[model samples]
Target: MQRRARTYLTGVALAVMLSGGLTACTGSPEDEGGEDTKAGSSGAPDSSAPPGRYRTLPEPCGAVDLSTLKKLLPDAEGAPQGSSTPGKGTASGDEESPYEGQPIATYDTDRRAGCRWKSTNSLATRNLTVDFERVVSYDPAVSDDEQAQLLYDERAGQAEIPTESEPPADEEGGEGGDPADEGGKSGSGGSGEDGGSEAADSGTDGKGGGEGGGDPGGEGEKSDSGGGSDASEEPGGEPSPSSDADLSPRTLDDIGDNAYIDDQLDTGDSGVHRDITLVFRSANVIATVTYDQWLTDKRRTPDSAELQEKARSVAEELAADFDDN
Candidate 1:
């Protein structure tokens, strides 16, 4: 009887082991990680945004064309230190040997890279710095472009550029040189100066300038007449009483998706110098061009028009290059 009991127990144990193996082969709901796993997930809709348009940044040191470099930095063609240039190097480091821009030091080249170039001449000493930043969104809900825009807005705010109050484009009244408005204003008195009024009137008198075809031509000449950007050799070339409105830091419409320019003047041991900076945003990347000139001659101030134009040109070139890529 004892032997029979031992055999029966062994058979029951074998049967139990076989039943467990069959259950394993059938698989559990959780084991498959299919429907069960999916159901267990948070089940929330994905609000994630698309990544930035640019995945990689260009090499900052090599991004600029040689011609542009030469134009901005006169000494780029290889000016020996103190080649009749007024002051010593404005930059902290030794002058760049051949004037190739010096790359800014950054741990992450993928996210940010910069190049700085300095040039000196008897007229004025100039420094140029170009920075490229690739924005990334930490929160899935925010996009790279949106994040970059926010950052740009912040930078612009810190610049202390006067708000759009001085701008005629605002609702209160800076119509941005409407030809009709120009006609009315000049009609009162601006028409007297044939050089200015005639040009403005002709520009406004229906020239295929889009809706405001004549507005640009007319206003540009008005500004020119007032010597706004081109402070020419006119007897009245000194900044007009209204020149503050023209020289004030203002937003630019023709550059990138959005852009602005800041101009500031400071007087110190180095005489009066002008600092012009252009900041623009393209997709998820932000490029900044900072060009400033220092003159030792306090008798003559640096011309805003020349520096502003050069800075804008560099910024525009950088923007165009970004678009191409």
Candidate 2:
């Protein structure tokens, strides 16, 4: 009986310890309720971040239309091939074929992509390249247009083209009136018959004198008028400003959201080559087209009109593709 009673007391002590441990492990209902409430009240996450305009980019090689490519690179060996696959010389045995145009591979397809094509004739060669870039703004406080404008400004600066800024008010007001006033003065002077008659009469009177004093005076007036005309013929009638063509890049209006063209000419013993680079921004994407042509005849250079026309066509096609996407 004593042994049994001792066992029962030991069991009761163990039960008390287990009950206390359970109470400590489990918190009060109020505390549990508070945690549940806190989790529920967290609500939705902050979504104030401004979204980027472009989420994806088009295929680099296929961005430009095949017909356009054919026109640009008429002598090219074959259709363009993508760099996604290995060229034939590679161990993979999937190397790009000689017939396939050159593929300009980029590390990131979603951000940047480009392709190139070249064809050589007996005496000349032609090359065409196209690139596409997707712009993404990281700043949440800035809008897409603002971000795009900033990027465009940077590109314009690099191309050495004019930015979209208002002309100085003073310059506008002064220059705006001068041309109109000069035109009016010229028109009135031309139409005034009385002045012409007076001049003619004076000339006749001077001619009557054997010394011909009027002839010298008339020649002097004619020389003075010729000099004035030459001055007026100059750009804006002031000392002619330097032409920006060879020195600075040119901005193109009516092309994409903004556009510019850069022309570079390289002359070597073999021949002269001209490279025309055209860049246009549409929405959050920028498309660059480079057209290069080599002429064996040193006297000949690539046609600017043809190059620009082709480049603009390719750019438009790329922009359309972006729109479709």
The 10 consecutive residues of candidate 1 with the worst lDDT sum are 206-215
Top candidate on TM-score is 1
TM-score of each: 0.58, 0.54
Please, what is the whole-model Cα lDDT of each candidate in the order they appear?
0.59, 0.53
| Candidate 2, run of 10 with poorest lDDT | 220-229
**Tens digits of lDDT, candidate 1, 145-258:** 887776666555445433232223243234456765654343322111122332232222212111201121221110121122323322222332343445557778888877
Candidate 2's TM-score reads 0.54
> Tens digits of per-residue lDDT for model 2 on 1-325?
9999999999999999999988877767768889988776664223234566677776665555555665665545443443432222122245553233455656788876666666555545666666766666566655454555556655555434556642333433434567855543333222221224432432232222212011212221100000111212222112322333232357777667888776655554534555566777777776777766565556655454455556668777766766666
Off by over 4 Å in 2: 1-49, 78-100, 166-249, 268-271
Model 2, position 144, has a per-residue lDDT of 54
